[model samples]
Target: MSAAGQTTVPFTVPSFAGEVSDAVVKVLDSGWVTTGPQTAAFEQDFADFLGAAHVVAVASCTTALELCLRAMDLPPGSAVLTPSLTFCGAINAILHAGHRPVLVDIDEDTLVPSPETVAAAAARTRPAAMVVQNQGGYPVDVAALTEAAGLDRTRVVEDAAHGPGAARDGAPVGSSSYAACFSFYATKNMPIGEGGAVATSDPDFADRVRAMRLHGMSKDSWKRYLPGGSWRYDVKSIGLKANMTDIQASIGRAQLAALPGWQRTRGELVARYDAALADLPGLVLPQRDLAGVQHAWHLYQVRVPDRDALIAELEAAGVATSVHFIPASHMTSYRAVLGEEECGRVPVTDRVAEELLSLPLYPGLSPDGQDRVVTALTGALRARS
Candidate 1:
């Protein structure tokens, strides 16, 4: 909410500093503006940031996930266990990679499949691999989850789309997952308008992702188009076109420099939200303050009784709210592919989807605006009571 005229608070805002625009302008001015040096720099910088052995920049997190899955070389239609409460992209990526998705149930509190849930699901499905998401920017303990599921570490793929800056088990995300995907969507912690990446320690996996992202080419255009470079390139295998552009990478590079401060701001804001909403009746605050973990605070979600009614009330009070997700199994498109039998009874995911409500969370959201949101939310809840 704004202090003047009290504008409605939006659920998310894409915060940007001046450097992003400056970087974009620089890229535009440079002769090369596609997937060239800027993209390469961003990939290297991201790898350094996460302490990963390799990183491949891509067009979107979904694309990165697909490419990673494709590199798995699993038997066609292999079962890939994934959370039902996660973004549809993870499930879609599995299907796109010629695999079957087995939707795993989530922990009601964490809004992610717990080790126990994953273990149970894995036992039932005997999955070939799993997509573990860092739900709401809170990193998952993939090592523990993998152990609980009795799966090899190499078979786990991380859907870290919500969190690029989050840390778990004494290491940053993308540091250890066999492969981890990240997003730089407009509303994400690292806003790049629309971009994503794949980070991994496996050199072969990185090479495969790089080749597949641009038509399985032996040489990327950047290498082929530079002065004294040959136009000829070899297509070694079937692949998709999902390369990140230099303009996006330029902005991403600038954003990377600004990320730490932005994350700190998010943490501070989340702290206020935790303290303020603690007293609100019938409200379930999101997972917070895990030991040895740094939450990215991507979405400050709260589960409220009468979620629909509260949203309407909040709307009337000039406050905006949105849900993190509707279970992928609940959506029609996935239903057509998964069918009822395949995606059966993600009981916790189904129940929690109704109550999960994402509140206003962004670097630009002022304390007063947050206060206004809180006041409106409190009023709305009180009215319903």
Candidate 2:
């Protein structure tokens, strides 16, 4: 018995009040809001927080990815191996940088590409780079991928969009990767409304990324504004305008300040959801495998039978839901590029597309809200049964 015209429980939302508001007020009072001291502090603090050697903040993850690709200066039409089950931005970044995206399938449960798949794709294409995604905050087997690709020929560009506090094995996400991109989009665990960063251990690569992120300028505006700073700067190359502003960084700084506590709450909430939904029929919980790895828990997506109808039922009962993605090849534009034969080859990603569903999971998601979600899901599953 699915009800009609039901209320909506938003899938994800930023719950910021105290520190975020305070930071914003201070930024307003200071009157130097566009990429100033706060932005620099946030960038430095974020790099320190993640234990990465360099961090360059950008307007969005797409920008961050694009800048990194451009910084690499791969030959035109160079292929970059990436999971097919990812946001279009990943693919777009490839095209924007005058390269081709070599889409690959993902593991069934993890929803991330396997190193074996990466190797097979690389062998087929001799890729210049591999963009691995930490799908749903589940860390990919980076070590395995590195071993397969070797150090010289393959460069890894990690789309750590869902991995802020996430880890692989014992290493924190973005600690020392070839190049890692993180998103602070409004829906992410650490929302800055619209901002992202690229992290890397290679100082030279980081410097290139910095140059490309802000009009290819020789120096950032902060350099010009600091004491004994010069006003003149040179434009080294043609770059996009994709710098993070202090206004957004103010919120990011606050969010970064509270990330650990937020992660703990998310973990607890996921455990609660797991315990409640464990035995429910027609539902498959997301999997976790790394023994010592930490998950940021950015999303708590699950798979279910007849996902569309279940989503309707959940909405009818005041629980919101979302799909992680519709496979990239399914889109009309990419369909032409990959062709039907190639698209059908990604069996794992194709299967998950029919059933993936994201539940409401955020720091301020109340216990009562979670209980309502579980109850609604239980009822929906029973009704479907």
Candidate 3:
């Protein structure tokens, strides 16, 4: 049973069956499955795609965020400004790096922190660094945000978990920041199951992340286990086990090659959604193609009335949906950190958290599937009204 009377439309389905499968099998047969040649190749390919100076593949985006913050070498308990309306990983990374997380509110339309808000928070907190997220794969104005934070580009990190092929002002997302972290989770825009990368133009920062992704060893295991490798190595600093496996990199290489086509398909799907749902009452569509930037169209989120009831209605109709976030300020752990007064500061975040709904949007999502989602949503909204 489905919204259109058959086959449920899923929230997300990774588009990897042919070439991706072949690539993974090839890696399995190669016998070197750790952070070896495949991982190196994937990193190089991704860097070339972004025109970035360096890129380091890691175990997950969470690890990449932590790695970037640790590379900053900030003092313990230093303030780090981040958005309240974002995935938990962003705030968690700030706390994990021995920094205090200062939650900022987001813009109502874009669901991203505005430059003015960031500037105001930076002035109040005098934060050592700022973590700006490209919420739902929409590229944020990093240059403006950096200027607002009153810090150089080096102190800004782009949490690009929803951005892989996204660009801003004729440049890739990672090209103009201190570091941009990408996710290749099962449901993210780029799917390699569980992997991520940190892209940066700074050679020194890239070097630090490369070393820190492993065990802070002077030489990586790939170098130590090679034919002419030496067993002798030196430890520099404490690090984490966040290196990406060659198997994951193998799949990522295939996905990276196909990213352009996949992005095109997503854009087409988004266009269809926009055209069909534009006039629906009590529903606000997500922002699209602001100024000169390209939106990655990773999530087709909409703000609707009776959000929970609409989700249930769609679920009964066989269309799976989800919420992008719960607003970090509302979470118990973040509430404890942000206290009561600060928690009530994010009015927009609080409202949007209750209204936002992510519909089905992915490369594999068929037009018929999208139509079903739209129909179900329309019916739900009308019924609620």
User: Of the candidates shown, which would achieve the greatest TM-score relative to the real structure?
Assistant: 3
Q: Write the per-residue lDDT of candidate 3 for residues 46-133, one digit (tens) a residue.
A: 9998888899999999999999999888888988889999899889999988898887788898899998888777877788998999
Per-candidate TM-scores read 0.96, 0.95, 0.97
Scored against the true structure, residue 42 in model 1 reaches a CA lDDT of 95
For model 2, what is the alpha-carbon lDDT of residue 278?
93
| Candidate 2, 45-88: lDDT as tens digits | 99999899888888999988888888887888888888899999
The segments of candidate 2 whose C-alpha lies over 4 angstroms from its true place after superposition are: 1-7, 150-154
Candidate rank order under lDDT? 3, 1, 2
lDDT: the better of candidates 1 and 3:
3
Cα error, residue 308 of model 3, in Å, equals 0.9
- lDDT scores of the candidates, listed in order: 0.88, 0.85, 0.89
Each model's total of backbone clashes = 0, 1, 0
